[model samples]
Target: MFKLAGQLASDCIVLGDFQLCTLLLMNDAQYPWFILVPRREDATEIFQLSVADRSLLMEESCLLAEKLKDAFAADKMNIAALGNVVSQLHVHHVVRYRKDHAWPAPVWGKSPAVSYTPELLNERIGKLRAVLTNGFTFAESCP
Candidate 1:
């Protein structure tokens, strides 16, 4: 059975699920950051996934990037799968703006993460849910 990394569970709110990944919203309100974690046990790298799963992951990542770009009117979409901290095979999709706090630099280590209030969190999730349709299923509960 697959289990979410403890760090991830503590840092993010369950957003929803795709065909092969569980979507998570990084609790930080600074940026519209999201993560897609494959529901595979003990898979620490993209190469660890089956060929079909790899392909599906790419598709899902691209779809998510596009939707987030449009939803947030982002200047850029930063997508990466660096598992240095958390070994789980998860992809990050961050919506960036030119005027954001850390524009030229990566979001990591640049500044502290600002968590959302309950109302703001719900509003952000609602915007995401509105765009992430079709193959996406919203989570029943976020907390």
Candidate 2:
């Protein structure tokens, strides 16, 4: 069975699931954002996924973007697959707006990641975990 891996950023809220992916929110408050980490073992490229999985990943990304839109009222969404710092195969879906701090520019390097306060972190996690646990389930089919 596929063992669910640990979250890279636990401070972020739990958005939902992508089946083979784990959807995470950035707690930085820098942007209304989410990250998708496929549960595959040691996959470094999107092409590593089977054709079916590749399609599903795209769908999952869309779902995360939509959820962020509704919850955060994001103006625009940015989806990226850059593996610069962390080598793990992860995708980032950042919600953007014209009036945002880093308008018209990529979020990376524009500002540092904002760490959530302890109380806020717990509260946010609670809210998101409730939504995600209610709306999503992880079925272990393989390791």
Q: After aligning candidate 2 to the native by TM-score, how far in Å is the CA of 129 from where it should be?
A: 6.6
Q: What tens digits encode model 1's per-residue C-alpha lDDT throughout 98-123?
A: 99999978999888889999888878
lDDT, candidate 2, residue 41?
Answer: 81
On TM-score, the leading prediction is 1
Weakest lDDT window of 10 consecutive positions for candidate 2: 134-143
Clashes of 1: 0
- Displacement of the residue 85 alpha carbon in candidate 1, Å: 0.5
Looking at model 1, residue 33 earns an lDDT score of 95
lDDT of 2: 0.70
lDDT accuracy of residue 52 in candidate 2: 90
